[model samples]
Target: MITEDNDPRKGKRPDPRLGSGEAPDLGGFTMEDGTVTFDWTQTRVRLARLADAGPVELGRRRRFFVARDDLAGVKLEFVPPLVQAIPSTCQSLDEYLNWLPEGLGRHLIVLIQAGASALGLWEEDRLVAHKAIKKYVVRGHGKAQPTYLRSKGKSRYGSRLRLRNARSLLVETSEKIHEWRNESGPFSRVFYSCPVRIWSGFLDGKPAPPLSKEDLVKIPLDVARPCFDELLRVRRRSLVGRVRTLGDEER
Candidate 1:
């Protein structure tokens, strides 16, 4: 009959600061329901100071989060004004901060699945250009289904056609992306959600988009079927910052 507090399996909470050593004196912040959020304009200065101080731990290279040792139970997370690559953990706080844009800039968003994709370029918060591409890449009746490469029945011919179209879709997607960048100028960042299976084909296009791996930030949220409206929803959500506090088990 071990009580909840007496459970031996539960260890003491680890410092939320991610063990950067000594804790700083962050006394005024509060976490409601283990989380909080801050607006970019209001908190940028305060965030800069926290990053400059010592004994901080970074959570992830993408969708960056930082916690100072002094703030033992709370973590400060950053959401890019739009989707963008974040500096790696190896980089210094100054370098990380420098990577963040002072204000929103033009960015590209690409949502891709087996048979469909949506691409859009945005300036500030306004969508400037967008395109949606779809193809018959799926076999049978299901939506966005992949072709069965080894089918032995009459579906085999259809499967092969689907596979070929899938490849073509990737090439078309890449070409369109390239065209947009050429007409609109370089994008500050590229946010994409391309599946691993098609990633090589996506990049192998003869005139692929001028995207560098370092500048690509994978979309972190689940997206429904690729469409222009879905792109707008994702863009809006990416700009909001979220803060989370560690629970006993999490710490």
Candidate 2:
């Protein structure tokens, strides 16, 4: 329910250094042209101070806003109460387009989470192609056990299984990245955001890594949900390791 009218710039000066990136000239902190901007550093600190601070609720998304003050300082605000701020997940190319800023053209956006991931290609704010994948779960439920009798076997096994799956998923994700480049058309730029650990272990690796230090954009995990959901809608097509492009019949 937050709106532009609540922008702090009208009344007070924002923190000048709030969102300056490693290289100030980069557009990461720019708020020009109605572009919705997010600053993970200041946002995280302020979020931790909120009384309701904790993990985001199930099936919801969170957003942090950064506004420019009249003096050029930066103002930061998040959707209040964080728990009920789910803006609804993007389900179609049009829906996803609505969430992005105007003037984006031929850019690749990839998002990865612990259990799911998504990749999409957009040109002039129109979705050209996309791919999404959902990791399968083998076990269903678990029962409480006494701490003295607790076993690490099940946890270790699950970790190993997930690691194996993650390795395979990494390869598939890399393939899609290449396809977006060589097959779809030459994307002007690529923006991929994910957790540091996930990015390092899988994406920042040898023989066709998905991202480089210069291109990775660090973002909150909550922001990753919609990307995951956007891809989830196309999981069926991606299962066959093919890129889903415009006008293609649904499988």
> After superposing candidate 1, which stretches have Cα over 4 Å from the reference?
1-32, 40-43, 49-55, 69-85, 141-147, 150-156
- Which candidate wins on TM-score? 1
The local lDDT score (0 to 100) that residue 2 gets in candidate 2 is 31
Counted clashes in each candidate structure: 3, 2
lDDT of 2 by residue, 102-200 (tens): 233455667765555688776543466777776642234332111112344445565556656666666777777876677766655555556666666
- Give per-residue CA lDDT, model 1, range 134-173, as digits (tens): 8888655663435344344444566767877887788888
**lDDT of each structure?**
0.62, 0.42
Specify the poorest-scoring 10-residue window by lDDT in model 2: 236-245
Query: Candidate 2 lDDT (Cα, whole model)?
Result: 0.42
Query: Which predicted model would earn the best lDDT?
Result: 1
How well does each candidate superpose onto the true structure, as a TM-score?
0.73, 0.44
